[model samples]
Target: MLSVDNLVASYNAGPVLQGVSLSVQAGEVVALLGRNGVGKSTLLRTLVGLVPSWNGSIRIDGTPLAPIATHDIARMGMALVPQGRGIIGKLSVADNLRAAMRAAGSRPALSIDQAIAPFPALREKLPAMAGTLSGGQQQQLAIARAMVGRPKVLLLDEPSEGVQPNIVQQIGQLVRKLADESGLAILIVEQNLELALATANRCIVMAKGRIVHSGPPDEFRNEAVLRRHLAL
Candidate 1:
């Protein structure tokens, strides 16, 4: 499980995340929805230590996390699939996955085959350069790499971005399967409404760096409610 309490973060002289708070339980998928610049992505980055937290606490399974390095955070069972996929284009797909496992440092981990099982399309591309793959393939590779570490919490930023519709559905199915089978707690920042609804059990809406609404997916599906907070 992951708990973030009154998290405050800033960029330069301006604050980006103002007292944001949320939590995700094991075997649950939570979608974070909002318009652009609402600090959805910043909250993810802050939880993973990419952005410094100015105040409050982030705890993984009740352990404070702000004191550790990002790599250590990954080793402590947190994995992030960043907004852009963030794959190493020049490296072979196998190497990219290997890097994450290496950073995870011998925790009970998933084999390459197990990691790639959800993405059978990526199984054959293991020896190929990651940059040469299509956008969907690259995103699959990114998710696979994150899973190889056998993380307890998965932070996914815009998993649907730049992905084809079919591939987005594939990702959604894989995410739901992971939550159910792997007990992976997922916090996904997504703009695509349908993808969010399909992938997450619950939805949290944010505005101006603060969470404004939290409920089941059906409440989020109501057009008027969604439009009020997300302006979608």
Candidate 2:
């Protein structure tokens, strides 16, 4: 359960998220869809404390989160898989996962095997250098590392970036399955329409840093409706 009310944030002189409000219920996956620079990524960054919130509130299971450090937010049951998979090139995939558990700091967490279970391909690649892996593999590693912390809410920003279509489809299926089985609330900012509509239980559309429409995936599938927002 994650809640954000009247959330506002800025970058230097210009405002990005203008009084945004949204919520993602447990066991649900909500896809954030919008064109480039509509503040979809900014909202995710702000929720995780990477970007300072100029106003409003963010709560995890009713616990207020703001004026909090990024690492502290991760410890408080929130994990972020950023736009670009931020894996250390020199570190092995196993070490990357271990680092996440360490940050969890004695919190009930998932073992390396359990974390990599969703990604069977990753099981064998654990000993491989993260930098040498393919783009899709790197994305899987990023998400698996985040899951090692057993977060209550997962903020995934553009998981499909640089990944192949088939792999993107696989990830969408995995995300849907992960939400149902683990009851982890997920808010994903995705540019890929097919993946978002396929995986998400609900879809929220953004424009000019504000949420303009919220509906079921079918609503967003309409060509006319999609054109109004995305023009694809």
Candidate 3:
């Protein structure tokens, strides 16, 4: 339900994203894969209006998104779980989630209990300070905060980064469940090729800030494609 066309973005005269184009259909999980500095995160940021699009069009369910404020894009049903798990360190877990819901302009369909059900460990840490949680717990909290918005399209940037193996699996399962059960379109920028292939039906590979390959996840599983575009 999201489409980006011929997107070009740069920072301080150096191009970061060059004419990147891609789309995500409702209920589909599209994995964005690239080596370091390929602009996968830049594309995600540009899509959500965090970065200005120098040249391109972004449409969400037919609504055009300009180079406007991030909140404005979020209000239109897109929520981003940024790479760093951008949570307020001092805020209670509950408040952090509530803030995300307010930012999305709606109360969450899933209650804190229900939302944390997917990550049972988070349920017990409701009153804890976000900064005090483990990295995995913090990542789960970040996803939980995004879920509190009940978004149509969830943009996740490197959810598994720095997370332990078990928690990464948990996050993967939750991501797949969100797409399958809730019909939430997911565009994930991930460095972990195996995790992306396991969770996503489709994969888009970027090289030097442009899309080089887009196809079924299985198709991208080839050794040659991995070595050429993704393996670092």
Candidate 4:
């Protein structure tokens, strides 16, 4: 479980996250959606310690995580699949998975083969350069790599950014499956309405660095709701 309370963070003293508070319980996938410049990404970055929070607390399973070290956060069972997927493009697919496990500095929760089990495409591309894979494949590698650590809380910035529609569908299914089967606590900031609606158990809308709306994914299906909160 991940809990953030009154989290306020800034870059160079200009506040971005203003008292943002939210929590993700085990087996829950909470989708964060809003227009750009609303601080969705900043919230995720602050959670992982990439951005410093001037106030509030972040706790994992009731354990406080100071906004100081990213590595320490990861080691404490929090993994991030950032906006760009952040894979080592030059490395082979298998090597990418190995690198993540190595970075953890201990035995990973899942072996390389177990990590790649969900992605059949990735299994066949083990020997190929990671850079050569499509954006969708690279996203898969990114998720698989993060899973090698068996994080209790997973933060995904945007998993369907450059992928095709069908692949996006697959990813949505996989994300939901992971939560259902492994009880992973997930926080995903997704602009793709379909993916968010299909994958998340609930949706929250962010505005000017704070949560303004919270509801089941179906509420977002109303066009008026989308236009009112998301400006779509």
Return the TM-score for candidate 1, rounded to 2 decimals: 0.97
lDDT per residue, candidate 4, 129-211, as tens digits? Answer: 99999999999999999999888899999999998999999999999999999999999999899999999999999999999
- Put down candidate 3 lDDT per residue, 90-196, tens digits, no spaces: 99998787777665565445567766778788887889989999999999999988887678899999999999998898889889999999899999988777789
* Candidate structures ordered by TM-score, highest first: 1, 2, 4, 3
Local error of candidate 4 at residue 103 (angstroms): 5.7
Please report, as a residue range, the 10-residue window in candidate 1 with the lowest summed lDDT. Answer: 100-109
As for lDDT, the candidate ahead, 3 or 4, is: 4
- Which lDDT tens digits does candidate 1 get at residues 1-232? 9999999998777889999889999999999988998898889888888899989899999999987888888888999999999999999998888877865656867788888888888888999999999999999999999998889999999999999999999899999999999999999998888999998999999989899899899888788997788776
Clashing pairs in 3: none
Identify the superior model by TM-score, candidate 1 or candidate 3: 1
Provide the RMSD of all predictions against the true structure, rounded to 1 decimal: 1.0, 1.1, 1.5, 1.3
Q: Which residue runs of candidate 2 sit more than 4 Å off their true CA positions?
A: none
Lowest summed lDDT window (length 10), candidate 3? 101-110
| All candidates: TM-score | 0.97, 0.97, 0.95, 0.96
List clash counts for every candidate, in order: 0, 0, 0, 0
